[model samples]
Target: MGVVSATARSDRYPKQDRSRATRQKLLEAAVACLAEHGWTGSTVTVVAERAGVSRGAAQHHFPTREDLFTAAVEYVAEQRSSALRELPAQDRRSVVAALVDLYTGPLFRAALHLWVAASHEEQLHARVTELEARVGRETHRIAVELLRADESVPGVRETVQGFLDMARGLGLANVLTDDRARRERVVEQWAGLLDGALGD
Candidate 1:
């Protein structure tokens, strides 16, 4: 009985690992497709092909297009949050730059696509709205931590939120053109403003 039990456990692990790996691949591929092609172009079949998994396998994991994309965005958001948490103590300027970089990445691009689609798609609206709210709260909390801001200090919370909003605006601008030079100037100016607004 013990030997049979051990054999069964060993057999299960490989299958479980493969399933996890497949799901991860699908999520990543979905994000890439969304970022590169936007919502109208990113379909389940396309994502499955990009992931190098069969459509049947992708469907088994996600069941629907909405499920795949929402999960993909959520998964990448968690990963970005983890990366943010892992940053070592840095100067406020560095922290500001790091936060801004978050909005300029592939994850943000993919999430923006999802947001645009959700605006017109009833089936996706509620799920995307909830996900964005959760992600927004987490990002704000992380920004506060990274900036060492005391929200107890009046205006500090709003200041942090304003910075995030500005970063998002910069991201939107970059979608049309390479705004690197202008963004650098803006980042420097914002870091100085943040230092004053969220003082030591």
Candidate 2:
């Protein structure tokens, strides 16, 4: 009986692993599709095709379109946050650049589409709003830790928020064009400001 039970449990592991992999593929494909095509163009069928999975498989992992997208963005955001935490200690300027880079990537683009869709789609509004709030808080906390900012100090917290706001603005600007040359200058200026604002 014990051997039979062990065999059944071991057999389930591979199936579970495959399911998780399929889910991950769907999530990644959804983010890519949303970033490149925007919300209107990114349907479950589109994502499933991009993921190389059947539509039924995608639906099995994510019951609804909203559920799929919201989970996709959240998953990528968590991955980015983990990457941020793992970064080696660096100079203030390097850290500032890293934070800004977070907003300038595909994840940010996908999230912006979701935000726009949520504004007009009542069913998606609450979930996206709540997701954004949680993501925002986590990003803020990561920023503080990466910058080693003393939030207890007067104005320090505001300075960190301002930096993140500036980074987000830069991200929005990049959606229209390759704003790297201009962005680098802005990053340098912000780094100087941060150094002054967050003194040793």
State model 2's lDDT.
Answer: 0.96
Show where candidate 1 strays beyond 4 Å.
none
Worst 10 residues of 1 by lDDT: 171-180
RMSD per model, one decimal? 0.9, 0.9
- Model 1 deviation from native, Cα RMSD in Å: 0.9
User: Each model's TM-score?
Assistant: 0.98, 0.98
Q: How close is candidate 1 to the true structure, as a TM-score?
A: 0.98
Model 2: worst 10 consecutive residues (lDDT sum): 1-10
Q: How displaced is residue 194 in candidate 1, in Å?
A: 0.6
RMSD of 2: 0.9
In candidate 2, list every pair of residues with a backbone clash. Answer: none
Model 1 residue 190 distance off true place after TM-score fit, in angstroms: 0.7
